[model samples]
Target chain A: MKGLSKDRLWAIIVLLPSIILLGIFVYGFIGRTVYVSLTDWGNDPAQAMALHPVIKFVGLDNYKELFSGFLQSRFRQELVSTIFFTVFFILGCLGAGLGLALILDRNPKGEGLWRTIFLFPMSLSFIVTGTIWRWMLQPQGGLNMAPTVLGGQPATFGWMSSTDAIWKFDWNKLPLLTASVVGLVLAWVAFGAFRRAERTRAVVAAICAALLLGWALFVGPNLHLLAAPELHGFNLALIGIIIAAVWQMSGYTMALYLAGLRGIPEELREAAQVDGATQTQMYRSVIFPLLAPISLSAMIILGHISLKIFDLVYAMSGPDNTFTSVPALNMYLTSFRQNQFAMGAAIGTILLILVAFVIVPYLSSQFRTQEGHA
Target chain B: MTARAERLTPGRIGMYLILLLAALFFLVPVYLLFATALKSPDAINLATSWHWPAQLNWGSFRDAWDKIGGNLGNSLFLAVVSTLFAAVLGSLNGYALSKWKFRGANTLFALMLFGMFIPYQAVLIPLFQFIKSLGLYGSIWGLILAHMVYGLPITTLIFRNFYADVPDALVEAATIDGAGFWQIYQQVIFPISIPGFVVVIIWEFTQVWNEFLFAATLTNTNSQPVTYALSQLAGGQAVSWNLPMAGAILAALPTLLVYILLGRYFVRGLLAGSVKG
Candidate 1:
């Protein structure tokens, strides 16, 4: 036992540098960031935008300011836009990626050549992709002017400057009203699930709906999610960035889907064909469901990238372009540029939690799977 | 992979057409970049952005090379150095964790991997201060350290997963033959780590080379990597489209070329590592 323990100790010693370096750089830095977020460091406008010797413990004031207080209004708006961007980006990438995968999966002409062309963007950095797409989506000069080269009319539309969202409602001041609508949608979904006999999902959804409806109706119009009645559009600017991101990532998802497609044996498709399944019907009913795991994996990857998008937005719109500001960029500007170190840390903490939400469960399950395999 | 009908059916033809259109869609941006890179300043504007350049402006590449060449060199140096450092450390850590059968090693691994999930934003402030305190801030070496530090988790994860595939019997036999830790590593493990090394090299090389945020925050003008340098060219006030496009190509081509040359390992590297996600 002593010899075994000694060997273990030696092993630990051998790994000490990795453990220590990761400890300070990773874990220790996270700890320090959290601590800094609590302190009122670098918040003063008149003070030098550097580390403060006489920093005071502000205790979530920075978070409060960003969330509801009037100082960091742009931050809150940016956060909302990030949500919109991520949701739409994921959808766009999945659709295009899966579509491309399906096309490639048909064993088309010169398949390897086509596959390489599709996946080529996966090789370029976001900075390069962003530059290209920035030029591509330049409102006056980019794809809009393609009409000109063909002797067609020039595009009159603002491709990346349009501010109109596909859908907009004036519920900014009516917070309770928005809650009720959300509650009703949940209730409807729960009701449908109940009809479908998904008991657990129904129960959870019902309870959430009940809580949201109860709060909205009883508490009335006071529970606010926004600091002001700010207009949030799908920012035509984000389309350019989204186009760039999707162009870059669709290839990756396509590759994943191709791998998934290859893993599916040909016998299954033949069986489906024997069942008189039409091509569209076969894909919709048979092939699409089988690609769920690949879809989930692709969504996870795209979600993470969209959340941490800085390079694409930076290269496309530049830093001052608030039309496509996201949490990562906001964190950078607030801390390094604005000198609001604590608030920046707060944003970073929020981003960490956001990333963890996507990653932690995936990792936990991955570890479990590896353990099972071993 | 698909169940081909063994004939050019209308559906197959349609699929080919769709693919060709999609290929053209994907190629347009790269095409624009190259075409714009070739054009003189007056040849490219709102009306002409999509058209071919009037003349091949080889001078723009020269101009771009002159401006961003130094930073590109820095990027190549930092990426190679950091990838080497991180890979070696990760390889050692992986060997110990996989073969040493030590207590607390799994816990240490789990702890280290938690770093992989952390958004780099979370650590920027403290990391900046920490590097400054160490008197290495604003230096290329500081940028390298930052890359190595963040690169540790993914590299360690890859190496660990790779080493875990090795049979226990080999290590046990090595042990019984009086081989010590480093001795077995040198003789039994290091020789066979080429594939694993390739995976980590492709992974970390692309990551550190394309990495911008850490380099942007940690380094000064002399130390700024090519990724940031490319951004500077784009954001610079003068609308010198040709040079920035050329710089973007210059910054982008190394990894792109590496992908073309070692694409099999690169794709395997991507599919194998969910640690990034």
Candidate 2:
């Protein structure tokens, strides 16, 4: 018979505020969101009720409209873009991050300098990241100046302009040199070169920061003037968002991989080397197998973040920027921007359903492993 | 690991090579910020092969400070309050879920786990509606509420794993002595859990301080957090790049200082017993 002491009650009382807030603001809203998604509220509160909104007993109709591309008309397209963004984003961030991790793990001479350089971009908000990247992608800004300097004509084409020319090009065979390709290809090509080139490394390294600043300057208003091409008229804005996100988040991935790399058993590597396993084999078979768990974890986290990415896209494209849409952004526009609260809530619930599908199984597996030990 | 000791093998060189290349990929953007911040605006605008800033413009810091509302007061306030709230409540929630075997405890814990999965953007609309409904919209407190909701799940998860490592014998002893929950928690439990507490505090503080989405969407004024304020500096007007750079540096300084000064704690706190898996 443990008695509830006065302080115990007080402690519980003190936690009441937080608990109440979480229960209502978090769990409650989620429930409401699910409920609202079932209704056909449309854009007007009047149609909410007049359009059969008795809490609208339409079971799965909203979900149908969402998938069928009927209700919002833009839902299906947005979903496709969201999925693409997620795939590219996850891979890009992980690749870049791992590459960064490998580089920084060498215990470089100026370790702090490199660490600070990698992490500083993370300090800026998504808005800033979006703004900076927008500037760097501009035809007249720092980004194009390189081409102009290299005896090439200055780029007047706005990569983010419209999607018109895209559909005409073979989607599968489209040149990797697309505007969205800027961050990924450039990071891989230019940055990759500087990474491996030793003596010139120091020289290029000295100039690397200037290049980043050049990109940052173009991230904001410069992005707004981007229009559509006459053909596909697809917004390349999504590409910029993905690029910026990968650039910013790769550092995080690198840090995680670095930690994982450090945890590898040295004795195994030594044994492999003594047996004459080549560097490629050691990495491919041994090191890679060992890094799997960390890699998987990184992938999971990166995938989840990519799926839910909004800040970079929203800030760069804005509410009306309309280059592309992720699930979160779609949800935001439906609710706040378009006044279709019910539809937005529905989209949110769908996102939650997707998130739950991934998270619940992973969590349960983890819990089971823990319980096995217990 | 002993392979490196055996000889300066080609493999080791390759490893170093890989490490160097990876480092460059990660470090460029950060380096650029410093280079640009130090450069005069005129030089920055000039496309002359992107060299180091001709002369250091330390005044960019001053410009950033003024443009970003003259100080980082709003950011500091939101971060401090959110961090403290998350730490205290998270620890308490962890304690309740871990130690107090009340009815629905497991269910409540599982329910709270959803906080991590629901991205800030997903809840932005409903949350905004909810906050506006509560009449707390546009206030720092509103942003605090939003951050706290997400902060709890992670913080509690960390503390729960940590508290699970605490043997039940001490708690049982205190209970047998009629010392009740609070007494055992304060006298017997907390003092020994300093390491876990530090980890929770550090993680929560960084999460709150570095947070952007809620801070930006929930509040619209300079009275918002530094992340949002710094963001607005760039988005608001066609001001000098130096101004936003100042705000960027100022916004970044607090976490950077903590990382530098309390680095050991930051590092240890990061990888300690607070388990996510």
Best by TM-score: 1
lDDT of 1 at A308: 82
Q: CA lDDT of B80 in candidate 1?
A: 98
- Kept native contacts, fraction for each prediction: 0.71, 0.23
- Return the number of clashes found in candidate 2: 24
Can you write out model 2's per-residue Cα lDDT over A273-318, one digit (the tens) per residue?
Answer: 9999998898899877887777776666666777777767755555
lDDT of 1 by residue, A1-374 (tens): 13574445666787888888899998899999999999888777655354445788988888878776766767766776777788988998888878888887777767878877888788788888888887788778878888887899888667556665654443354467667888999999999999999999999999999998998877866656565565555566677777778888888888888888888888998999999999889888888899997788777777877888888888888888776788899999988888788889999998888888887787676666655444
DockQ of each: 0.63, 0.26
Per-model TM against the reference: 0.91, 0.76
lDDT of 1 by residue, B20-89 (tens): 8998889988889999999987787866887788789998888889989999899999999999999998
Candidate 2 residue lDDT tens string, B1-277: 2234335568667866766665655554445556667776676673542456778888888677666653278767777787777877778777766776444455556667667767655466668777877888888788877777778877777777778788877778887898876787789877877777777777667767766667756776645777666666666546666566556667767777776665545654444321353
Off by more than 4 A, model 2: A1-20, A40-42, A45-65, A68-73, A100-124, A146-236, A270-279, B1-20, B35-60, B99-107, B167-180, B220-222, B262-277
Docking band of candidate 1: medium
Point out where model 1 deviates above 4 Å.
A1-10, A49-52, A163-166, A169-209, A225-228, A266-286, B1-6, B100-108
